[model samples]
Target: MPAESAPVGRRERNKQQKLERIVTAAAELFSERGVDEVTTQQIADAADIGTGTLFLYAKTKGELLLLVQNSHYADALERGRAASADARTPLDGVMALATPIIECNRVQVENGRTYLREMVFGDPTEPHHAAALAIVGETEQALAETLSRLASIPAAEASALARVVSSIMFLTMASSDAEVDIAQIVEGVRTQVSAILPR
Candidate 1:
C-alpha cells in the first residue's frame, strides 16, 4: 500500500494563519487609507502580530502590498479572461481582457500605481515580487492568446503584439493624471490597441 501523506504540523498551520491575518489586515488598511498612508506597525497591530513577525512574512510595506494586491490582480485577470471569450473580434477580445485590469488598478489609484512601481523595481528575490511578475507574464500570455484569434497573426507576432498591448495598459494605469477615470484609461488602451492591430 502507498504511504499516506503526512498532515500539516501545528507550526505550519500557525504560520499560515499568521500569513492570512497579515494579508487581510494589510488589504483592509491599504484599501482604506492607501499604501502610502499606512505603516508597517499599523499592519502588524491590525494583524495581531508583532512587527518582527510581520517582517518575516514581508520585509517591507511594498511586499505586503504585493501579497495583498497579487490576489486581487489575479482575480481581475481571470475575470478579463472569461469576458474575452465572448468577444467577436481581436480588438474586442483584447479590450475585454484589459478592462478589468484597468478597473483593478484604479480601485485606489495611488496604491495601484505603487504596485506597478514595485512590480517593476522591487527586489525580484522576494517571493511576493516574483509572484507579481508572474502575474504580468500571465497577463501577456492571455493577451497573446486573444490576439492569436486573428488568423493572420502568427504566434511570434501575437506574442509581440501582446507585449505592446500590455505596455499600453500598464502605461495608462501608471499615468500621473489621477483624475483619469477607468473609462478614460480603457478608452486610451482601446485606441492604442486599435491603432496597432492589422487593418
Candidate 2:
C-alpha cells in the first residue's frame, strides 16, 4: 500500500478498462455486422472513446482483430494444454490436440470462419497472421513434443506430423457451426492417418 505503487496500479487498471471497452465494442459490432462492415469509428463510438483513442490502442483494424483473436485463442489453447496433460496415446494426444481447438472455434464459428477465410485467401497483411503464429507457435511446440513422444519419431518427423495434424484441424474446425456434424470428419481423419503414414 505504498503511495508510489498506487499510481502504477491505477495505470494498469485504466489500461485494462480501456482495452475492455474496446474489445467489448469490437466483439458485439463485429459479430452483429460482420468484419467487413464494422468500422474503427463505430468501435470507438461504442466504447465511448475517440477514434483517436482506438488508434492509440491499435494501429489498424487488423491489429485489433489480432488482439481480440489472441485473447480468445490463448484461452482456448490453455484449456487444450490442460486437457492434454493426462493423455497417453498418440490418437489420444491427437484428440487432446484437436478437440479443444475445435471446441474453441465452436464458440465463435461464424466470425471465425469469416476471419480465417480472409486470413488464408484474402490479404497478405492480416494482423492475425503474426499473432496467430505466436499463439500457435506455443501450442505447436507442445503438439510437436507430444507427437514425437507418441510416434517415436524424430523432431523433424514430429514437426511435419504436427503441421499435417494442424492442417486437418484447421480444415475441420473452420467448418464448425452450431449445426454442422463434424463427427464424420474426425472419424475420417482417424481412419486415414495410418493410411497416409509410411509403413
Candidate 3:
C-alpha cells in the first residue's frame, strides 16, 4: 500500500479496536445487569475510555445495545447461511436460515426486545438504525439466494418468498409471549412457510 494509506488504515484499525472494547464491556454489563440498569459512565469506565468517547460511539443506551449486538447478529446470519447449505428442501433451508437468528435473540431477551423495538420505530437516520437494516438485508439476501438455488425459482420470486418468510420469523420472535417456547415459534414459521412455498 501507499504511504498515505498506511496511516488511514492504522487509524481505522485503532478505531475498530476501541469500538470492540466498548462493545465487549457493554455486552457483559447489559447481559449481567440488564439494559435498564447500566449507565454510560459505567460502560466507559469498563471500556477504559472517557465518557465523552463513549458518546462518540453511541448517543444513548439503546444505540449502545445495537452497537454491542450488531456483530453477534451478523455472525448468527452467517451461521444460518452456512447451515442452510446442508438443507434438503426449501422449507428446511428456510428453517436453517431462521433458527440461528432466533437463537441469537434468545441470548439477551430484554436487550433483543429493546433493539427490535428501536429498530422498528427509532430514528431512521441513526447509525444503529442503519446497522439494523444492514443485518436484516444480509439475512434476507442469504435466504433469497438459498431459496433461488434450492427451489429453482427466479431471484425476484425467491426474494419475495424470502420476505414472506422473514416477516413470519420476525413476528414469531417479536410478537410472541415471553413464556412462549422457541421451538413452538420456529414450528409456526415452518408451518407458515410450508403453506406458502411452492411444491
| Residue-level lDDT tens digits of model 2 in 34-73 | 6668899999999999998888877777666666766777
Q: What's the residue-level lDDT of 3 in candidate 1?
A: 100
The numbered model that scores best in TM-score is 1
Off by over 4 Å in 2: 1-15, 31-37, 118-129, 175-179, 182-185, 188-199
- Model 1 ranges with Cα > 4 A deviation: 1-3
* TM-scores, each model vs. reference: 0.97, 0.75, 0.89
What would the per-residue lDDT of candidate 1 be over residues 126-185, giving only the tens digit for each residue?
999999999999999999998888435889999999999999999888984789888888
Q: Which of the predicted structures, 1 or 3, would earn the higher lDDT when compared with the native? A: 1
lDDT of 1: 0.94
- Stronger candidate by TM-score (1 vs 2): 1
Q: Pick out the ten consecutive residues of candidate 2 with the lowest summed lDDT.
A: 190-199
Collision pairs in model 3:
none
- Please, what are the lDDT tens digits per residue for candidate 3 over residues 33-145? 87888999999999999989889988888899988888889999989998999998988998998898988887767777777877777777899889998898888899899
Error of 2 at 127 (Å): 6.8
Residue 154 CA displacement from its true place in model 3, Å: 1.4
